[model samples]
Target: MKVAMWSGPRNLSTAMMYSFAQRADFAVLDEPFYGPYLRLTGLDHPMRSEVLGDRRKDAIEVEQSLMDPVPDGKPHAYHKHMCQHMIDGIPRSFMAECVNVFLIRHPARVVASFAKGYPDLTADDIGFDAQAELFDHVRSLGQTPVVIDSADIRDDPEGMLRGLCETIGLEFDPAMLSWPVGPKPYDGVWAPHWYTSLHATTGFAGPEGPLPDLNGHLAELVARTMPAYRALETKKISQSMKL
Candidate 1:
Protein backbone atom coordinates (compact mmCIF):
# COMPACT_ATOMS: atom_id res chain seq x y z
CA MET A 1 0.00 0.00 0.00
CA LYS A 2 1.11 3.54 -0.66
CA VAL A 3 -0.06 5.93 2.04
CA ALA A 4 0.05 9.61 1.20
CA MET A 5 -0.27 11.62 4.40
CA TRP A 6 -1.23 15.26 3.83
CA SER A 7 -0.73 17.82 6.56
CA GLY A 8 0.34 21.36 7.35
CA PRO A 9 3.49 22.45 9.16
CA ARG A 10 3.87 21.82 12.91
CA ASN A 11 0.87 19.52 12.82
CA LEU A 12 2.67 16.47 14.20
CA SER A 13 3.48 15.53 10.61
CA THR A 14 7.17 14.74 11.24
CA ALA A 15 6.48 12.53 14.24
CA MET A 16 3.83 10.64 12.28
CA MET A 17 6.33 10.09 9.46
CA TYR A 18 8.85 8.78 12.00
CA SER A 19 6.27 6.31 13.29
CA PHE A 20 5.72 4.78 9.86
CA ALA A 21 9.43 4.74 9.06
CA GLN A 22 9.93 2.40 12.01
CA ARG A 23 7.73 -0.15 10.29
CA ALA A 24 9.88 -2.70 8.54
CA ASP A 25 7.71 -3.10 5.48
CA PHE A 26 7.46 0.60 4.78
CA ALA A 27 9.75 2.79 2.64
CA VAL A 28 9.16 6.43 3.53
CA LEU A 29 9.54 9.50 1.34
CA ASP A 30 9.90 12.90 2.94
CA GLU A 31 8.42 16.03 1.38
CA PRO A 32 9.03 15.18 -2.26
CA PHE A 33 7.42 18.48 -3.27
CA TYR A 34 9.48 20.74 -1.00
CA GLY A 35 11.90 21.69 -3.73
CA PRO A 36 9.11 22.45 -6.15
CA TYR A 37 7.16 24.47 -3.57
CA LEU A 38 10.19 26.57 -2.69
CA ARG A 39 11.00 27.08 -6.31
CA LEU A 40 7.51 28.12 -7.30
CA THR A 41 6.74 30.35 -4.35
CA GLY A 42 10.18 31.81 -3.71
CA LEU A 43 9.04 32.42 -0.15
CA ASP A 44 12.53 32.33 1.33
CA HIS A 45 11.66 29.87 4.05
CA PRO A 46 14.39 28.81 6.43
CA MET A 47 17.15 26.92 4.61
CA ARG A 48 15.50 27.81 1.30
CA SER A 49 18.70 27.65 -0.70
CA GLU A 50 19.68 24.33 0.82
CA VAL A 51 16.24 22.88 0.19
CA LEU A 52 16.31 23.98 -3.41
CA GLY A 53 19.82 22.57 -3.69
CA ASP A 54 18.89 19.14 -2.34
CA ARG A 55 16.63 17.66 -5.02
CA ARG A 56 14.75 17.94 -8.28
CA LYS A 57 12.66 21.11 -8.31
CA ASP A 58 10.26 19.93 -10.95
CA ALA A 59 6.78 18.96 -9.77
CA ILE A 60 6.52 16.58 -12.69
CA GLU A 61 9.52 14.53 -11.59
CA VAL A 62 8.48 14.61 -7.95
CA GLU A 63 4.93 13.46 -8.72
CA GLN A 64 6.29 10.68 -10.91
CA SER A 65 8.54 9.55 -8.09
CA LEU A 66 5.58 9.36 -5.74
CA MET A 67 3.90 6.82 -8.02
CA ASP A 68 7.06 4.80 -8.73
CA PRO A 69 7.91 1.67 -6.82
CA VAL A 70 8.91 1.97 -3.21
CA PRO A 71 12.67 1.77 -2.70
CA ASP A 72 14.60 -0.98 -0.84
CA GLY A 73 12.00 -3.52 -2.03
CA LYS A 74 9.64 -2.55 0.75
CA PRO A 75 6.02 -3.71 0.52
CA HIS A 76 4.62 -0.27 1.27
CA ALA A 77 5.51 3.40 0.86
CA TYR A 78 4.52 6.28 3.12
CA HIS A 79 4.87 9.70 1.54
CA LYS A 80 4.94 12.58 3.98
CA HIS A 81 3.53 15.71 2.36
CA MET A 82 2.92 19.31 3.29
CA CYS A 83 -0.59 20.39 2.30
CA GLN A 84 0.70 23.80 1.33
CA HIS A 85 2.97 22.26 -1.26
CA MET A 86 0.09 20.98 -3.36
CA ILE A 87 0.06 24.26 -5.21
CA ASP A 88 -2.00 24.93 -8.36
CA GLY A 89 0.96 23.86 -10.43
CA ILE A 90 1.17 20.36 -8.93
CA PRO A 91 -1.01 17.65 -10.37
CA ARG A 92 -3.72 15.93 -8.31
CA SER A 93 -4.28 12.92 -10.58
CA PHE A 94 -1.89 10.69 -8.62
CA MET A 95 -3.86 11.01 -5.41
CA ALA A 96 -6.42 8.51 -6.66
CA GLU A 97 -3.66 5.93 -6.96
CA CYS A 98 -2.82 5.86 -3.24
CA VAL A 99 -4.58 5.92 0.08
CA ASN A 100 -4.58 9.59 1.12
CA VAL A 101 -4.94 10.60 4.74
CA PHE A 102 -5.24 14.05 6.25
CA LEU A 103 -3.51 14.71 9.55
CA ILE A 104 -4.81 17.72 11.43
CA ARG A 105 -4.43 19.70 14.66
CA HIS A 106 -6.24 22.53 16.42
CA PRO A 107 -5.64 25.87 14.72
CA ALA A 108 -4.50 27.50 17.94
CA ARG A 109 -2.01 24.72 18.56
CA VAL A 110 -0.77 24.92 15.01
CA VAL A 111 -0.48 28.72 15.18
CA ALA A 112 1.25 28.69 18.56
CA SER A 113 3.83 26.18 17.41
CA PHE A 114 4.29 27.36 13.82
CA ALA A 115 4.53 31.10 14.58
CA LYS A 116 7.77 30.80 16.54
CA GLY A 117 9.82 29.84 13.50
CA TYR A 118 7.68 31.70 10.96
CA PRO A 119 6.85 34.87 12.83
CA ASP A 120 5.37 36.45 9.75
CA LEU A 121 2.90 33.62 9.31
CA THR A 122 -0.09 33.71 7.01
CA ALA A 123 -3.10 31.41 6.66
CA ASP A 124 -1.70 29.93 3.49
CA ASP A 125 1.54 29.32 5.35
CA ILE A 126 -0.36 26.97 7.70
CA GLY A 127 -2.06 25.10 4.83
CA PHE A 128 -5.51 24.59 6.38
CA ASP A 129 -7.36 25.70 3.26
CA ALA A 130 -5.32 23.49 1.02
CA GLN A 131 -5.80 20.51 3.31
CA ALA A 132 -9.57 20.88 3.18
CA GLU A 133 -9.57 21.33 -0.57
CA LEU A 134 -7.43 18.23 -0.97
CA PHE A 135 -9.79 16.34 1.25
CA ASP A 136 -12.62 17.24 -1.07
CA HIS A 137 -10.53 16.39 -4.09
CA VAL A 138 -9.84 12.92 -2.73
CA ARG A 139 -13.51 12.50 -1.98
CA SER A 140 -14.31 13.55 -5.51
CA LEU A 141 -12.04 10.74 -6.67
CA GLY A 142 -14.31 8.25 -4.87
CA GLN A 143 -11.91 7.75 -1.99
CA THR A 144 -12.96 8.51 1.53
CA PRO A 145 -9.66 9.69 2.84
CA VAL A 146 -9.03 9.07 6.52
CA VAL A 147 -8.62 12.07 8.79
CA ILE A 148 -6.73 11.85 12.09
CA ASP A 149 -6.07 14.46 14.72
CA SER A 150 -2.68 15.10 16.31
CA ALA A 151 -4.07 15.43 19.81
CA ASP A 152 -5.84 12.07 19.52
CA ILE A 153 -2.65 10.36 18.43
CA ARG A 154 -0.62 11.96 21.20
CA ASP A 155 -3.26 11.04 23.74
CA ASP A 156 -3.03 7.34 22.93
CA PRO A 157 -0.52 6.47 20.30
CA GLU A 158 -1.01 2.74 20.42
CA GLY A 159 -4.77 2.77 20.40
CA MET A 160 -5.01 5.44 17.73
CA LEU A 161 -2.38 3.85 15.53
CA ARG A 162 -3.94 0.46 15.93
CA GLY A 163 -7.29 1.86 14.95
CA LEU A 164 -5.79 3.75 12.05
CA CYS A 165 -4.15 0.61 10.77
CA GLU A 166 -7.34 -1.36 11.05
CA THR A 167 -9.35 1.35 9.33
CA ILE A 168 -6.96 1.27 6.41
CA GLY A 169 -6.89 -2.56 6.28
CA LEU A 170 -3.32 -2.65 7.59
CA GLU A 171 -2.10 -4.78 10.46
CA PHE A 172 -1.27 -2.96 13.62
CA ASP A 173 2.46 -3.25 14.27
CA PRO A 174 3.81 -2.59 17.72
CA ALA A 175 6.87 -0.99 16.15
CA MET A 176 4.83 2.06 15.15
CA LEU A 177 4.51 2.99 18.80
CA SER A 178 7.95 4.61 19.05
CA TRP A 179 11.19 5.46 17.29
CA PRO A 180 14.77 6.16 18.34
CA VAL A 181 15.46 9.69 19.51
CA GLY A 182 17.04 11.71 16.68
CA PRO A 183 16.75 11.59 12.93
CA LYS A 184 16.15 8.69 10.59
CA PRO A 185 17.76 8.30 7.18
CA TYR A 186 14.46 9.17 5.45
CA ASP A 187 14.08 12.62 6.98
CA GLY A 188 14.05 15.47 4.44
CA VAL A 189 16.98 17.88 4.22
CA TRP A 190 14.81 20.47 5.94
CA ALA A 191 14.49 18.30 9.03
CA PRO A 192 17.09 20.21 11.00
CA HIS A 193 15.24 23.48 10.52
CA TRP A 194 11.86 22.01 11.49
CA TYR A 195 12.29 18.93 13.65
CA THR A 196 14.24 20.09 16.68
CA SER A 197 11.60 19.34 19.35
CA LEU A 198 10.59 16.12 17.62
CA HIS A 199 14.20 14.89 17.39
CA ALA A 200 14.45 14.74 21.18
CA THR A 201 11.51 12.37 21.71
CA THR A 202 11.16 8.66 21.07
CA GLY A 203 7.37 8.74 21.10
CA PHE A 204 4.41 11.05 20.74
CA ALA A 205 4.07 13.70 23.44
CA GLY A 206 1.26 13.62 25.96
CA PRO A 207 -2.23 14.83 25.09
CA GLU A 208 -2.17 18.42 23.92
CA GLY A 209 -2.64 20.98 26.65
CA PRO A 210 -5.20 23.75 26.84
CA LEU A 211 -5.61 25.65 23.59
CA PRO A 212 -3.06 28.41 23.65
CA ASP A 213 -4.29 31.92 24.09
CA LEU A 214 -3.83 34.01 20.98
CA ASN A 215 -4.11 37.63 19.95
CA GLY A 216 -3.46 39.96 17.07
CA HIS A 217 -2.50 38.18 13.87
CA LEU A 218 -2.24 34.80 15.56
CA ALA A 219 -5.80 34.99 16.88
CA GLU A 220 -7.01 36.01 13.47
CA LEU A 221 -5.30 33.05 11.84
CA VAL A 222 -7.03 30.58 14.16
CA ALA A 223 -10.38 32.18 13.50
CA ARG A 224 -9.94 31.90 9.76
CA THR A 225 -8.76 28.28 9.97
CA MET A 226 -11.28 27.01 12.50
CA PRO A 227 -14.07 26.37 9.99
CA ALA A 228 -11.89 24.12 7.91
CA TYR A 229 -10.48 22.44 11.00
CA ARG A 230 -13.95 21.81 12.36
CA ALA A 231 -15.17 20.48 9.01
CA LEU A 232 -12.45 17.85 8.95
CA GLU A 233 -12.64 17.36 12.71
CA THR A 234 -16.18 16.02 12.29
CA LYS A 235 -14.85 13.26 10.05
CA LYS A 236 -11.82 12.32 12.15
CA ILE A 237 -11.15 8.88 13.62
CA SER A 238 -12.09 9.47 17.20
CA GLN A 239 -10.71 7.67 20.28
CA SER A 240 -14.16 6.26 20.83
CA MET A 241 -14.06 4.65 17.41
CA LYS A 242 -13.15 0.99 17.04
CA LEU A 243 -9.55 0.07 18.00
Candidate 2:
Protein backbone atom coordinates (compact mmCIF):
# COMPACT_ATOMS: atom_id res chain seq x y z
CA MET A 1 0.00 0.00 0.00
CA LYS A 2 1.13 3.54 -0.76
CA VAL A 3 0.10 5.80 2.12
CA ALA A 4 0.10 9.49 1.32
CA MET A 5 0.09 11.40 4.62
CA TRP A 6 -0.44 15.11 4.05
CA SER A 7 -0.05 18.13 6.31
CA GLY A 8 1.44 21.61 6.49
CA PRO A 9 4.70 22.79 8.04
CA ARG A 10 5.50 22.61 11.80
CA ASN A 11 2.77 20.03 12.32
CA LEU A 12 4.72 17.07 13.70
CA SER A 13 4.99 15.73 10.17
CA THR A 14 8.62 14.69 10.41
CA ALA A 15 8.07 12.75 13.63
CA MET A 16 5.15 10.91 12.03
CA MET A 17 7.38 9.98 9.11
CA TYR A 18 9.99 8.76 11.56
CA SER A 19 7.40 6.67 13.39
CA PHE A 20 6.30 4.93 10.21
CA ALA A 21 9.85 4.45 9.01
CA GLN A 22 10.65 2.34 12.06
CA ARG A 23 8.45 -0.38 10.66
CA ALA A 24 10.31 -3.04 8.72
CA ASP A 25 7.67 -3.23 6.01
CA PHE A 26 7.41 0.46 5.22
CA ALA A 27 9.56 2.54 2.87
CA VAL A 28 9.41 6.26 3.55
CA LEU A 29 9.68 9.27 1.24
CA ASP A 30 10.16 12.77 2.61
CA GLU A 31 8.61 15.83 0.99
CA PRO A 32 8.74 14.37 -2.50
CA PHE A 33 7.50 17.48 -4.33
CA TYR A 34 9.37 20.11 -2.34
CA GLY A 35 11.97 20.81 -4.96
CA PRO A 36 9.40 21.18 -7.70
CA TYR A 37 7.29 23.51 -5.59
CA LEU A 38 10.28 25.69 -4.81
CA ARG A 39 11.29 25.74 -8.47
CA LEU A 40 7.85 26.63 -9.73
CA THR A 41 6.97 29.25 -7.14
CA GLY A 42 10.39 30.98 -7.16
CA LEU A 43 9.76 31.60 -3.47
CA ASP A 44 12.91 32.59 -1.66
CA HIS A 45 12.96 29.68 0.78
CA PRO A 46 16.03 28.90 2.83
CA MET A 47 18.35 26.39 1.14
CA ARG A 48 16.53 26.72 -2.16
CA SER A 49 19.57 26.03 -4.32
CA GLU A 50 20.55 22.96 -2.33
CA VAL A 51 17.01 21.55 -2.48
CA LEU A 52 16.86 22.07 -6.25
CA GLY A 53 20.10 20.17 -6.57
CA ASP A 54 18.83 17.19 -4.52
CA ARG A 55 15.62 16.41 -6.42
CA ARG A 56 14.48 17.01 -9.98
CA LYS A 57 12.41 20.19 -10.32
CA ASP A 58 10.09 18.71 -12.92
CA ALA A 59 6.57 18.20 -11.49
CA ILE A 60 5.72 15.28 -13.76
CA GLU A 61 8.93 13.51 -12.88
CA VAL A 62 8.27 14.00 -9.17
CA GLU A 63 4.74 12.65 -9.58
CA GLN A 64 6.06 9.62 -11.40
CA SER A 65 8.53 8.94 -8.64
CA LEU A 66 5.76 8.85 -6.04
CA MET A 67 3.89 6.30 -8.13
CA ASP A 68 6.90 4.11 -8.62
CA PRO A 69 7.41 0.76 -6.88
CA VAL A 70 7.98 0.86 -3.11
CA PRO A 71 11.69 0.80 -2.51
CA ASP A 72 13.41 -2.46 -1.48
CA GLY A 73 10.20 -4.35 -2.11
CA LYS A 74 8.70 -3.05 1.09
CA PRO A 75 5.04 -3.91 1.63
CA HIS A 76 4.02 -0.28 2.13
CA ALA A 77 5.26 3.23 1.34
CA TYR A 78 4.78 6.22 3.62
CA HIS A 79 4.91 9.52 1.81
CA LYS A 80 5.40 12.60 3.99
CA HIS A 81 3.96 15.53 2.05
CA MET A 82 3.49 19.24 2.65
CA CYS A 83 0.11 20.47 1.40
CA GLN A 84 1.57 23.84 0.34
CA HIS A 85 3.63 22.01 -2.25
CA MET A 86 0.52 21.23 -4.29
CA ILE A 87 0.64 24.44 -6.24
CA ASP A 88 -0.68 24.91 -9.79
CA GLY A 89 2.05 22.94 -11.51
CA ILE A 90 2.15 19.88 -9.21
CA PRO A 91 -0.05 16.93 -10.12
CA ARG A 92 -2.68 15.43 -7.82
CA SER A 93 -3.77 12.59 -10.08
CA PHE A 94 -1.75 9.95 -8.27
CA MET A 95 -3.43 10.66 -4.93
CA ALA A 96 -6.33 8.48 -6.05
CA GLU A 97 -3.96 5.55 -6.22
CA CYS A 98 -2.71 5.96 -2.66
CA VAL A 99 -4.42 5.96 0.74
CA ASN A 100 -4.53 9.69 1.42
CA VAL A 101 -4.51 10.75 5.07
CA PHE A 102 -4.74 14.35 6.24
CA LEU A 103 -2.71 15.24 9.34
CA ILE A 104 -3.78 18.47 11.01
CA ARG A 105 -2.72 20.58 13.97
CA HIS A 106 -4.37 23.48 15.73
CA PRO A 107 -3.70 26.73 13.89
CA ALA A 108 -2.49 28.50 17.02
CA ARG A 109 0.16 25.86 17.69
CA VAL A 110 1.14 25.84 14.03
CA VAL A 111 1.51 29.59 13.92
CA ALA A 112 3.42 29.77 17.21
CA SER A 113 5.98 27.22 16.08
CA PHE A 114 6.11 28.52 12.52
CA ALA A 115 6.55 32.23 13.15
CA LYS A 116 9.97 31.70 14.71
CA GLY A 117 11.24 30.24 11.46
CA TYR A 118 9.39 32.45 8.98
CA PRO A 119 8.67 35.98 10.09
CA ASP A 120 7.02 36.96 6.79
CA LEU A 121 4.67 34.00 6.91
CA THR A 122 1.17 34.23 5.51
CA ALA A 123 -1.87 32.06 6.12
CA ASP A 124 -1.36 30.16 2.87
CA ASP A 125 2.28 29.60 3.72
CA ILE A 126 1.26 27.38 6.66
CA GLY A 127 -1.01 25.22 4.42
CA PHE A 128 -4.30 25.07 6.40
CA ASP A 129 -6.17 26.37 3.35
CA ALA A 130 -4.49 24.03 0.92
CA GLN A 131 -5.07 21.04 3.18
CA ALA A 132 -8.79 21.75 3.41
CA GLU A 133 -9.02 22.07 -0.37
CA LEU A 134 -7.24 18.75 -0.90
CA PHE A 135 -9.34 17.04 1.78
CA ASP A 136 -12.47 18.06 -0.10
CA HIS A 137 -10.95 17.01 -3.41
CA VAL A 138 -10.23 13.54 -2.03
CA ARG A 139 -13.81 13.18 -0.86
CA SER A 140 -15.01 14.40 -4.27
CA LEU A 141 -13.18 11.42 -5.73
CA GLY A 142 -15.44 9.18 -3.58
CA GLN A 143 -12.62 8.43 -1.17
CA THR A 144 -12.90 8.84 2.59
CA PRO A 145 -9.66 10.42 3.62
CA VAL A 146 -8.59 9.75 7.19
CA VAL A 147 -7.97 12.83 9.35
CA ILE A 148 -5.79 12.61 12.47
CA ASP A 149 -4.83 15.38 14.85
CA SER A 150 -1.21 15.75 15.92
CA ALA A 151 -2.28 16.80 19.40
CA ASP A 152 -4.15 13.54 19.84
CA ILE A 153 -1.17 11.51 18.76
CA ARG A 154 1.09 13.23 21.24
CA ASP A 155 -1.42 12.71 24.03
CA ASP A 156 -1.71 9.00 23.40
CA PRO A 157 0.69 7.78 20.78
CA GLU A 158 0.04 4.07 21.08
CA GLY A 159 -3.72 4.23 21.17
CA MET A 160 -3.95 6.84 18.44
CA LEU A 161 -1.53 4.96 16.22
CA ARG A 162 -3.44 1.77 16.65
CA GLY A 163 -6.62 3.58 15.71
CA LEU A 164 -4.93 5.12 12.71
CA CYS A 165 -3.52 1.78 11.61
CA GLU A 166 -6.86 0.06 11.89
CA THR A 167 -8.62 2.83 10.00
CA ILE A 168 -6.13 2.51 7.16
CA GLY A 169 -6.29 -1.33 7.12
CA LEU A 170 -2.78 -1.79 8.47
CA GLU A 171 -1.81 -3.70 11.58
CA PHE A 172 -0.34 -1.92 14.59
CA ASP A 173 3.35 -2.44 15.14
CA PRO A 174 5.18 -1.55 18.32
CA ALA A 175 8.11 -0.34 16.28
CA MET A 176 6.13 2.66 15.18
CA LEU A 177 6.40 4.12 18.66
CA SER A 178 9.99 5.30 18.31
CA TRP A 179 13.04 5.57 16.10
CA PRO A 180 16.71 6.33 16.70
CA VAL A 181 17.91 9.90 17.06
CA GLY A 182 19.28 11.68 13.94
CA PRO A 183 18.30 11.48 10.29
CA LYS A 184 17.34 8.36 8.42
CA PRO A 185 18.62 7.53 4.95
CA TYR A 186 15.42 8.62 3.22
CA ASP A 187 15.29 12.15 4.68
CA GLY A 188 15.12 14.85 2.03
CA VAL A 189 18.18 16.96 1.28
CA TRP A 190 16.57 20.00 2.94
CA ALA A 191 16.46 18.27 6.34
CA PRO A 192 19.21 20.44 7.75
CA HIS A 193 17.23 23.61 7.26
CA TRP A 194 13.89 22.30 8.59
CA TYR A 195 14.55 19.16 10.60
CA THR A 196 17.09 20.36 13.11
CA SER A 197 14.78 19.85 16.09
CA LEU A 198 13.64 16.48 14.76
CA HIS A 199 17.17 15.09 15.07
CA ALA A 200 17.19 15.62 18.82
CA THR A 201 14.38 13.20 19.56
CA THR A 202 13.76 9.49 19.39
CA GLY A 203 9.97 9.68 19.69
CA PHE A 204 6.99 12.02 19.73
CA ALA A 205 7.12 14.78 22.32
CA GLY A 206 4.64 14.81 25.18
CA PRO A 207 1.23 16.41 24.86
CA GLU A 208 1.46 20.11 24.05
CA GLY A 209 0.79 22.74 26.69
CA PRO A 210 -1.86 25.46 26.45
CA LEU A 211 -1.95 27.12 23.06
CA PRO A 212 0.82 29.61 22.56
CA ASP A 213 0.17 33.20 23.51
CA LEU A 214 0.07 35.00 20.18
CA ASN A 215 -0.68 38.63 19.54
CA GLY A 216 -1.02 40.79 16.45
CA HIS A 217 -0.07 39.14 13.15
CA LEU A 218 0.33 35.58 14.46
CA ALA A 219 -3.01 35.83 16.20
CA GLU A 220 -4.64 37.06 13.02
CA LEU A 221 -3.10 34.26 11.01
CA VAL A 222 -4.51 31.67 13.41
CA ALA A 223 -7.92 33.30 13.26
CA ARG A 224 -7.86 33.21 9.47
CA THR A 225 -7.20 29.47 9.49
CA MET A 226 -9.73 28.40 12.17
CA PRO A 227 -12.66 27.76 9.82
CA ALA A 228 -10.64 25.45 7.64
CA TYR A 229 -9.10 23.88 10.73
CA ARG A 230 -12.45 23.30 12.47
CA ALA A 231 -13.89 21.85 9.30
CA LEU A 232 -11.27 19.12 9.34
CA GLU A 233 -11.03 18.96 13.12
CA THR A 234 -14.62 17.77 13.34
CA LYS A 235 -13.80 14.75 11.21
CA LYS A 236 -10.71 13.69 13.12
CA ILE A 237 -10.86 10.30 14.81
CA SER A 238 -12.60 10.56 18.15
CA GLN A 239 -10.20 11.31 20.98
CA SER A 240 -12.14 9.12 23.37
CA MET A 241 -12.06 6.13 21.04
CA LYS A 242 -10.35 3.22 22.73
CA LEU A 243 -8.57 1.47 19.94
Give the C-alpha lDDT of model 1. Answer: 0.91
Give me the candidate number with maximum lDDT. 2
Model 2 vs truth, CA RMSD: 0.9
Superposition TM-score, candidate 2 onto the true structure: 0.98
In each prediction, how many residue pairs overlap at the backbone (N, C-alpha, C within less than 3 A)? 0, 0
lDDT value for candidate 2?
0.92
Error of 2 at 165 (Å): 0.1
| Per-residue lDDT of model 1, residues 1-243, tens digit only | 999999999998999999999899999889898898888888989988888999765999888888888899999999999999999788777798899999999999999999999899999999999999999999999999999999999999999999899999899999998899887788888889899878899988998778999999999999999999999999999999958
TM-score of each: 0.98, 0.98
Residue pairs with backbone overlap in model 2 = none
Q: Compose the digit string of candidate 2's lDDT tens values, residues 1-243.
A: 999999999999999999999999999999999888988889988888988898874999888888889889998999999999999989999999999999999999999888888889999799999999999999998999999999999999999999999999999999999999887788888788888888999999999999999999999999999999999999999778738
Candidate 2 residue 182 C-alpha distance from true site, Å: 1.4
- In model 2, the worst 10-residue window by lDDT is 234-243
